[model samples]
Target: TLSEIATMAGVTPSTVSRALNPAASHLLSKKTSERILALCDHVGYRPSLLARGTATGFTYKVAMILHDMEKDLNAHDWNRITCATSAFLQESGYSLVLLRTSEKGTSMDMQVSHFLMSGIADAYITSPSMLKNNTLEMLNSLKSPLFVICEHGVPFPVSDGVLRSDADAFKQVWSRIPKEMHGKICFLSTINDNTQRLLTNIKRAAWDLGIDANNAISTLSLARTSKVPAMEYAEAYHQTKKMIKSFNQFDFVWCISDFFALGVKDALTECGRCPGKDVFILGYGDLETFPGVSEKPVLSTISANTHEIARNMCSVIMKKLDGEHTDIVTVKSSFISRSTF
Candidate 1:
């Protein structure tokens, strides 16, 4: 069918092939590409992915391995990141294959290995949480393109992935808070590796600014408290309400997420405290709202900048496919000032 289309367009089969692939379509003149595409539309010819893969040795699909979709499917940050990644890949003539490493009916390693051996994807985008001890070894042995989305302390080669520089982000955001409000800082956190690392960085940033962590810094881990449950927003709301009296001790409240920040703001408002005037509030992942129809987010936060991450991921992946050398990319987060601050 492609050969017939090429014949009608007065071009070679190879030219037709390049024109059909959006990523490589620029190789042809606009006039030539338009003619080929119009001819295909006239004939109602749709290219088969299997046929194209067999011929080009590329499946034009990227496997995105995720962990525990059952719970994380509700996360606003991950949803944004995944949607952005898919949109970027789609523009580059690639499809995304979502694979869960947990809550599936098979072992995570086995499922990943099967896909790798089957040539089901041209490349893979994965994070550290999706990998295990054995899975990392298998993934590293892959000759095809593999891009990792991780923070610090991953075992992969530096050139193969991107890192989120949250520590640097903390430093940037900390300096922007009102100097007077820096006297009593309280970190509202959850028990996780990322939260631990972030708290360490936050404390270091304060210390660098001539604020003593021992005297000014205090932490309340939501995960360790009995009042906290599965839901992040609800846990934050109830916990802040239960400890509303204690909140008077803090001059600044740094929340782990926008949801928590909003919850804390609401609780403070209900308890007759001015959030911005009394206690400056800051949150992470500058999300405007929840995943579905929900309360609008108005808290000042450090934006994870999913759009930039997606652009960088797609760029590096394309470069790798074109046999170009790529090094570790560090994406920086920025602060978003809002009424809460």
Candidate 2:
């Protein structure tokens, strides 16, 4: 096949081989390499994995480890990240293998250990949740590169990963709030590490802006006991309705997510309060649609730019695969202002 491609490109077989090899391709002239590559493409001549392995000693496979795969699969941010990462890895001539920590009766530790021993992938990209206690230390012991995608404020010791910038997003939102609503803003968030970080950022920003942080920021944490598929919306609705019944001092409410914001709007309507008129509502994550909210007000929220995060993540992994060190990367979020604020 090499000989055939070389003859068609008017180059020797050895020259074609060198041009096609990833490591040695740089040694050949640009014109010759491009000609050989074009010829190979025209012929649909994908090199055999066995041959490539013999030459490079790499599996060319990257594994993405996800926790709570079923729930995350439907999540907009996770879906976008997975799709973008897969596309980028494919473009870089690598295949992606997805491993769910919750699969089978196997624990996260067992799954990771098995994969490490089996050599199923050359490198790994995982969520911060998967790297807890001994798991992170175990991964660090391996020769293979490991990358983590961490929540906005969760501290990750490793230097090769991406951290979402929820703090920046919160600051942007706080800075843009009307002066009239400065001391009358309420925050509704789920009791999670990421949301806690966001709330902390909001409080810090308020303090920095000379606003009374304690009086300006009122927070309600929705419990995670509910198992409903739409638990976020349901919890927000119930909690907000309760809050409205007892306390109605706040003029603006910021939710941790758009889905929760929609529920907050519904609760406000039930309490005889108009969403945009009586109280402006804000949320994070620019979801496309919210169910049961027909006349949806344009929501003021933060867009995480999952695509950019995925691209950066893939770039870091690629650098690691090439035996290069990568610094920790943080992807900043942008605020989208609309009628809700």
Reference-based lDDT, each prediction? 0.74, 0.75
Tell me each candidate's TM-score: 0.87, 0.82
* Stretches of candidate 1 exceeding 4 Å from the true structure: 29-31, 102-108, 131-135, 138-141, 153-158, 191-194, 208-211, 223-230, 289-297
What's model 1's overall lDDT? 0.74
Clashes counted in candidate 1 amount to 0
Best by lDDT: 2
> What tens-digit string does per-residue lDDT give for candidate 1 at 1-341?
87888788888988998888899899989998888888888888868987878877888888877665644444666677778888999989998898666543458757767777787687888754455323455565455778887665445543566777676677776777666655578899766525776777778876777767656668876654432223667878888898877787787889987778877888888888888787788988876644553465568888878778878888888888888889878887887787788
lDDT of predicted model 2: 0.75
